[model samples]
Target: MSRWFRVGALASVAFVLVVLGAALRPLVLPEAHTAASILNAVEIGFAQDMAAHHQQALIMVQRLDRGVDPTVLRLAQQLSDAQRIEIGTMLGWLRLADASPLSAHPMAWMHTDAATSQHHSNTSHANSDAMPGMATTAELDALAAARGHNAETLFLQLMFRHHQGGLAMARVADELLTSGPVKETARSMFQSQSQEAGVISVLLTQLGGQAPH
Candidate 1:
């Protein structure tokens, strides 16, 4: 990661985020304000929680060593770009709906859905700190301190587990919202994350690292 390459990468990321944000603004605004119906609790809650979930993903990508394998860097770039756009989209919905961008109760939204309740029964007492598959503070610290292959392996393992948790939330949202932009978004998230997780698994195996339990 020469200084020039680092600068170029940052610029590219910024350009993508700006372009995607502008393109998505119309899609998020129309239903939010022009539609006759209001956004339901499920929709609002999902946006809030999932946005926060995606924020952590950006952090994981940032903590990765820039000197790692090019393949790993490319994957990180893809995930970061996609999730940054999604975070913007989710925040747009929250702004239009007059909802908080952060969920005060985190996964508490899942409790309203019976299916989610049954599926996450073990997490009845979960909080933001207990969100499934979130890397602990110490874990993140370790990742930041790691270098080269070590950082790459740890990132893949952490991100793989993070996707699993977020995918669970998206699945619940998809099932709970019968028809809405939120449901559609959740379904898309599930599909995209599932594919990314698979690729991550293969990469982790190649790096001789097991996905974190």
Candidate 2:
């Protein structure tokens, strides 16, 4: 065979091997299982809403990426990474269950009469645009423009409230979601966010700033 032809044949063979290797690669997907009877429509709804809730927390931490305070910047980076991964996990659950992330209203899943009885009596508001622990666009804008200690203070305060809000949702998920994966996730959220909240509280005190009310 001609040298040029031999080289072309080898190149074709290599290309085919690469294509077959890619085709045979395993697709890593979230596992799915049958939902417990207690994990009814409400549980699914709660998971969907909470996933959206976590997304806002993720957004808030991302804002601190541009911040100037070393401590605040570090916390923000850590929070963002952690929540981003959780958000993905929750989103995978929603997809597996054929649930929608964009719910009709924020916290709608926890709006049932029975669930509401478990908490203080208050009128529920239906705001699809709002997440439980989210900073307002105005507040976010201010944080983005701030520098130095002021930025650190604001980031901590916002994050403190953010974690509190997440804990509330996590608590609800713990009480409501009954399936194995759902319960496991809710419990994990409760534990992780609760721990992070404590860390933030200490940092707030160290920074000479009060935690959010």
Output the TM-score of candidate 2.
0.72
Summarize candidate 1's per-residue lDDT along 124-188 as a digit string, tens digits: 32453356667778999999999998999999999998998888888888888899788999999
Model 2 C-alpha lDDT versus the unseen true structure: 0.72
For this target, which candidate reaches the highest lDDT against the unseen true structure? 1
Deviation in Å, model 2, residue 204 alpha carbon: 1.0
Model 1 scores a C-alpha lDDT of: 0.85
**Compared with the true structure, what per-residue lDDT tens digits does model 2 show for residues 94-139?**
7776767667665666766665553232222244334556678899
Mind sharing the TM-score for model 1? Answer: 0.78
| Structural similarity to truth (TM-score) of each candidate | 0.78, 0.72
Q: Which candidate tops TM-score?
A: 1
